[model samples]
Target: MTHLTLALDAMGGDVGPCVTVPAALQALASNPGLHLLLVGDPAALHPLLAKVDSALLSRLEIVPAESVIASDARPSQAIRASRGTSMRIALELIKTGRAQACVSAGNTGALIGLAKLLLKPLEGIDRPALVTVLPHQQQGKTVVLDLGANVECDSAQLVQFAVMGSVMAEEVLSLRNPRVALLNIGEEETKGLAAIRDAAAQLKNTPSINYIGYLEGNELLTGKTDVMVCDGFVGNVTLKTMEGVVRMFLSLLKSSSTDVGRKAKQAWWLTLIGRFIQRRLAKRFGHLNPDQYNGACLLGLRGTVIKSHGAANQRAFAVAIEQAMQAVQRQLPDRIAARLKTVLPKSD
Candidate 1:
């Protein structure tokens, strides 16, 4: 495999250098051909670098940055005051042709704001949408978009998201004629907001996309459709809810095991059955672990930008870097731009 260079906003995450540096090192170890440009205060990163193997040190380079955008920073504040922040510098590496892609576990609003301002939107894209892969029941993955980037979207914008997301599913997920759907309260044509209905109508008429009409929230991970399109507010809420549910189940599984352990001494057979059930649940829910699906790509941008979960651990953060590498390798932005030219409405 050819080597790919990626820029990391080492100061963006909640734990800052502690998480980002180790994640970068892990990514480098996993992909021998991968090189990382770590952007942050050298003083904070140097100690971590010392722990890395000398051979790998050559593959990792630190780019000094003076500031960082807080996770709670508003978009406006980030744009106006974060010119020299690690996130901005990492993005600049992409514009300068020094890095193939950039990954950040920073403020979502700030990352979106800076990415659009610095990289600009792809031609024919009104705005970029946050897209991520979700594990599907068919032992496959679905590409869901507008994952908290645009809180509200017009009908045309929703249609545009469908177009971009379909292309992404085809190009990245390698799904041929990937099915598309609008997320709504109900699957009926008359249900949902006018924007969703209008977008559905547009998708149904559009010959290029495999629009499967509206899909209710229940069908999200069933592999019923390859792409789920919705406004950011709804998409974000749905994603977070699913994540919360997964966490809840996993927590319950852990607690149940402990409760069963004490009773095991009293009733060996019952404890054995309980342990069996716990193991099965763990195996099943392990697939839905958010860490495995940590990276969310910002689609329709001029260059590749991946947003990792802000609270991600090192292993999870490495997945985000890998996501960026995949996008760069596939030329995702160019592919979306080409597809949009043919499918997007004339007004756009």
Candidate 2:
């Protein structure tokens, strides 16, 4: 197989080169058929590149960029002033077909704006939705969409998100005839806002999707549906809340184990039991770790663009790169366009 080429915005995210450089090296080491274009200042990236193995250097190239977009910069400011920044340059590579995908941990707003501007949206897609896979109870994963890309969506936009998200689930998760649902306060047809109700009605009539009716927010991770669709505001809040709950539960588990060890220092049997329990809990909750699922894809774009969490560490950023590679290999944009052609109205 030919090597997949991906562009990395090396100066993106909180730790920038410190995290991205190592992540890039790690991704190269794991995937032999992967080529990476690291876009950032040569001066800043050279020292980090020195630490990489000589063999991997052949597959990695540094494309120097002078500027870096600030993590807090507004989307409008980034769009105007970030012309030569690493984030923008990496996206340009995708637009020009020099790279199959682009991954960045820059400001979410800025990344979304830049990607939409550079790559444009797919046909019949008025706006792109931010999508990510969340671990489900059935040992599979659920695809969630509009995770902070557009806070408000009309009925038609919600239907569009469902179509795009369903394609993502089928392509990335390999689900056949994936069940799609609209996120609502209740499962009843009468529940939720007018837009959601209207979207639900449209989805029920649409032949392309396996429309599964309304799903309450509580069913998000229960594996009740393969795809969960919502406006950005609701999706973002739900995602963050779940992340926080996972972190809190894990923290408490660790604290409890520490307390048990201290209290049972003289009792070897008790310590052993506590250690065993802690290990089991850790192993089970490992799937819920947000770091391993760091990438949020900007779906419906003509080209692939993955947004890594701004605060992502090396491991998390590596996961983001993997997400981008999956989307590229799956030809996500083309798949979405094909689905839309059959489902969307001729006027779109």
Candidate 3:
């Protein structure tokens, strides 16, 4: 029998338990063996549970506590001081083996800090990077690592991220021998920073992984690379920039108003134009569901810690729950540890 439990932060995001609860209910309907330990004020979540049917409600276990950690609180202090905070409690469940993984769309900084403290990285992992799947044109999904967790990283760290990400794509997405690429300014041999150049050399020499050389930002959506790697600062900036651009284009598309003159038969044409634009925008940027990405998986940690966007919606929360379930099913952490054990350590 599959025995997996997830600890969810019911009071983490902007929507709080409202979104989190519904997502939990959604996940439970499909996964019977999956148990949920919702951490928040019992009273608050109980009302949400009232809306769920008895069958789904029985699968959930509400672990109520008093404190709530605001996004403004210092992450380190917040995790250290707030013992009863929902995020900390969820982490505790994973640490204590009560839950297989933890998912929270809470304060990302605090989530990262708390997770690092609670679940130490694999024996030699210098950093625990966040990995998110970016939508691709033909290949379905692509894995990008170090998405804002470690701002400063060495060449060795980048290489490690590539190895871990390769394993993830193969395991989770079932991509056989996923091709790896280092994110660089250009595809040329000597076009990146010192770190990229060094990582490129390291990757060339690295065995077991299908390293496909360097890739620029434009290559990400083309499905040319299955696993893209970079330092946290660069990856984070790129992710945000792409998201911003999508939003900007979507806004422009929405604002393109057709002139329906009072003395002309352009009203029908205007309506047609409006419908076409709406469909195109929805088809293009509609996939920008943060909920679909849900929470990012904190790779390199001993256990899984999923970080959700601060302003995540119900869709995002639901997606996060599914991601958490997939992580447990794939045995990602153990696979990563085993693979890393064979890789050479970075020289000081």
Output the better candidate (1/3) by TM-score: 1
Ranking by TM-score: 2, 1, 3
How high is each candidate's TM-score? 0.96, 0.98, 0.90
Among these predictions, the greatest lDDT belongs to: 2
Best by TM-score: 2
lDDT by residue for model 3 (1-348), tens: 386799999999877888888888888887888889999999898888776788878778998778778877887778778688899899999999999999998887788888888898886688799999988878388999999989989998898899899999999989998999999989899798998899889888878889999999998778998999999999999988877787686667666533223224657766786677667766776676444575789999899888877777777777888888888899999999888878756423
What are the runs in model 1 whose C-alpha is more than 4 Å off? Answer: 266-277, 346-348
Show model 3 residue runs off by greater than 4 Å: 1-3, 254-285, 346-348
For candidate 1, lDDT tens digit of each residue in 1-348? 698999999999889889999899888988989999999999999988876788899999999999999999788978899878999999999999999999999999999999999999977788899999999898999999899999989998898899989988998889999999999998778998999988888888899999999888899999999999999999999999999998898998878876786666758777777778788888988889989899999998899999999999999999999999999999999999889889985543
Itemize residue pairs with steric clashes in candidate 3.
Answer: 291-316
- Of the two candidates 1 and 2, the one with more favorable lDDT, higher being better, is 2
For each of the candidates, give the backbone clash count: 0, 0, 1
Compose the digit string of candidate 2's lDDT tens values, residues 1-348. Answer: 457999999999999999999999999999999999999999999999886788899999999899999999888988899878999999999988899999999999999988999899888888889999999999999999999999999998999999998999999999999999999998778898999999998998998899999988789899999999999999999999999999999999988986786696558788788888899989999999999799999998899999999999999999999999999889999999999999998543
